[model samples]
Target chain A: MSEPIDRKTVESVARLARIDLPEDQIDDTASKLGDVLTYIGQLEQVELPDDVEPFFGAIESVNAIRPDQLTDSVDREQILSNAPDADGEFYQVPPVL
Target chain B: MDLSTLSAAELVKRLSSGELTAESCTESFLERIKDRDSSLNSFVSTAESAISAAQAIDERRSTGQAVGALAGLPVAVKDGICTAGIATTAGSRMLEKFVPAFDATMVKQLLSADAVVIGKTNMDEFAMGSSTENSFFGVTKNPWSDQHVPGGSSGGSAACVAADLAPVSIGSDTGGSIRQPAAFCGITGLKPTYGRVSRFGLIAFASSLDQIGPMARSAEDCGLVMNVISGHDSNDSTSAKNDVPDFTQTLNDSLKGLRIGICKEHFGEGLDSEIESAVNESVKVLESLGAETVEISLPHTPYAVATYYVIAPCEASSNLARFDGVRYTHRAATAKDLTEMYCQSRAEGFGEEVKKRIMLGTYALSSGYYDAYYLKASKVRRMIKHDYDSAFEKVDLILGPTTPTTAFKIGEHTQNALAMYLADIYTVSANLAGVPAISIPCGLTSAGMPVGLQLQARSFDEASLLRVAHQFQLQTDWHTRRPNA
Candidate 1:
């Protein structure tokens, strides 16, 4: 198996994912993550053809753009209705400054 | 006659003939949900608008106005699909109170077809787990056995149909999410070809793999729903441009001289002995119906689970990034800064399984690990797709068991994530290959739990998949068996 994911790496990943994991769960999280990585490490052993292309999505016609035109939009009140904190028209967020 | 016992197709004939009113049919389902859903926990929210809609259909029919295909049929939709003014939580706490301002494209189609929207069903949180145990609401119990899990993230959709709470329900499948649950609950589930059904309103799990499908009592019932839902939509760019065909037209067609491929890889290693026997028996029934079966090889099948784990998480990590505190519901109250608010809100909102996948996906797509994990897995995905493409050259359909075993008890695999992930081994390849597949109940295990026989056809070939499944249901009584619950 490849090197096990260390707690430091797990912590860094949580930071990158923007999830605030608690300190005590770090080691447990790292172990679980390592288990998954080890399971997926089997892919490294397969010899792939160098010419093969990496697939990002299914094969279908691309650039399916529609003609630009004005269309009906959802009501402004309905759109903001689900916001946790909305000022009737605008969503409220923590001040960046 | 009990309206709940009739299939969607049967209900359509009755409603059209004026033997039963849509209002009465809607009332029966609402009454059943009230009586039974307390034990099953299949529904997240029931719609009062469903009754009003059914009443409108009755009014139209009495006034001699033409109604749509599924006039008056009450159908449940999985919570992941947005409904205008209805709470679509996706079984997660993060969107506990979030209601969409507009209906999902498919929901709009369902409404236009004049079907009553009964309620939103439960599922795995963010469509993440193999069992419904991961839902923030609570685990959905299998209709066959309350102690066992209804396989997820479309568990509620499957369970509701099996329990006769709804004649048909809509589900979204990423990796076997629809089929596995259908197998566990003893019903029919279809995962249409990728982009066959528009995903405009579906909460993204793995955008490349996620496809909304139909779950119902029989293949014919599934086909009826498929007819209404499968079509092109300008809103979903990935939605196929292929013309929608009448899926039920070939239900009675002879399967004589059809070539069915039996992949050796699907039947070996870790598969339950009872399930193996049942699936083998299903092949015999198909052969007896005048179809020929041949042994085929999908050598890269072993890599599907691993490749899916890498690819799905990578997409999910990106898709879920929109759940930050700036938009929709759930914000951290104690955060003093912008970054802290984002972090703390997500940490509190998402469940354990969702957090684990997010982290795994973040690690895989990290700057240094990109080539080693995400890109490598993508190449392997191509090989998996090629395996299906080459096999289809020699056969019309590929057959296999839907899951390795029947439904296990709730909390069985919650502690071990890898074990839970393996439950999708037989179901993921079709998703990775972007093909149409269906799961129909074939037999019951020694414990009386149901086993699903899966049939996969070439991409955009749901017509063939539905035809074959319909024929099999006609020959066997398996799909007719109902749980004692």
Candidate 2:
């Protein structure tokens, strides 16, 4: 909980979430998040056994998949129909690096 | 006859027996949506196309053709679900105009079973907030008290069902999104085991904890809907391949010898007195049904809220990265470069709460902090799951208050994010453990708001969960009580 959440850190998180935040709001959010972190810090007092394993995913299996089955799906036009901007066969977007 | 007041089982019976035509039920609900939803703000999009769909079902009925199990029963889907040409916003402006090309696997299953989707309901933007206040559209008021919030990210779905706008609505539970609001509004809602239902079309929030389940007036209807929606799906790699049981068929079995565990941690200090009474009274009803209750310990419960806050947002930060403007959804109004465009689009599209979570999650999972915060939290989450595993060894099911308090006034906790986050204290543990849990109406506060009692069962055991919940519904009429909207 003592870990500091600064503006740059907040901005990086927004980027990870794919939401662009204004430079100004970053510091403000960092402070507010600091309060939330301080609140969550209360959990540190709860003691548990050393051997107990931490839970990361669901109790069940993970990423269990099957071979790609090509079944009839909607056409590209229908699939891309709602894209804000798209070319004839592709979703149009600004150039990516 | 108000279509909203009817239960799915009742409506399905009438539709099947020809006592009520599918077209009539569709028209009634559509009319109710037109008349009430403007003020309630429950539905995001209504199915004008449903009239034609209903007429087709009517035609089939007249022709003696086979109709699906839920045919003609009106269901409201959470906006997060892909509805094939219908907008699936996940209540964020980022995907405002994004309509899915294909139906979600659950949607396809419902259609095959003959469930007529009435509309898509509103939710917290990206399913972040406890109250629907975080929705990009606007806040959804509790149907019981218009000034108070309907608990959310599934708030709108819960509100619609509460006000009788839709017979049964579907909501996705990431934390307590579905069950909390169901409790707040005095309805029955279930969050099945993580892989029990396919998440193929659900807009990803925290992929690991997210599960789409049923919200309706009765446990039976929830079981009915669960039976239809639960099963394996190739599209969702995580969906379980096990055979789904007939939830309704096993619902009435006596809970005579089944053990119900009551956690002392849940009935702790901060819980509202009214909620405590409601849980106690519901337990009495269970006792009347001949089931014995045993006090159980979930010592790690205190750390559950903290663990969930770290884990859910950490995953959401990763899952939501797809919303970048370069690839999809919102684009900047004006930008000098691609970077500016990406940033501006995101800043403008997401709501404040969503941004807050992104920041929190990002910080926790950041390079320097991951092991200390995110990894540490994951370890606590494992302990929480272990707590449930240990408790289940002694009892068949666990019961407690769904939310410590009933729905608060709309703007009550908006300024205090942590207080609102704490509202999910009792509900998040189940999500962390990936078990089947349900919230059913047990009692109401003096202010007339609903109080929900939550019951949880081990992995893939929704059958027992529903049976106990259904028996509770049978012995008590709390679930049948409705808000006078």
Best by TM-score: 1
Cα-based TM-score, every candidate: 0.99, 0.96
- The docking category that best describes candidate 1 is medium
Q: Report the lDDT tens digits of candidate 1 across residue range B188-265.
A: 999999989999999999999999999998999999999999999999989998898999998888999999999999
Error of 1 at A50 (Å): 1.7
Off by over 4 Å in 2: A11-19, A46-48, A59-63, A95-97, B1-3
lDDT of 2 at A96: 57
lDDT of 2 at B60: 94
DockQ of each: 0.76, 0.57
Off by over 4 Å in 1: none
Chain B fold agreement for model 2, TM-score: 0.98
B396-473, model 2: which lDDT tens digit per residue?
999999999999898999888889999999999999999989999988889898999999999999999899988888
Per-residue lDDT tens digits for candidate 1, residues A1-97, read 3567998898899999999999999999998888899999999987799898887777546688888999999998887877777899898887886
* RMSD of every prediction: 1.0, 1.7
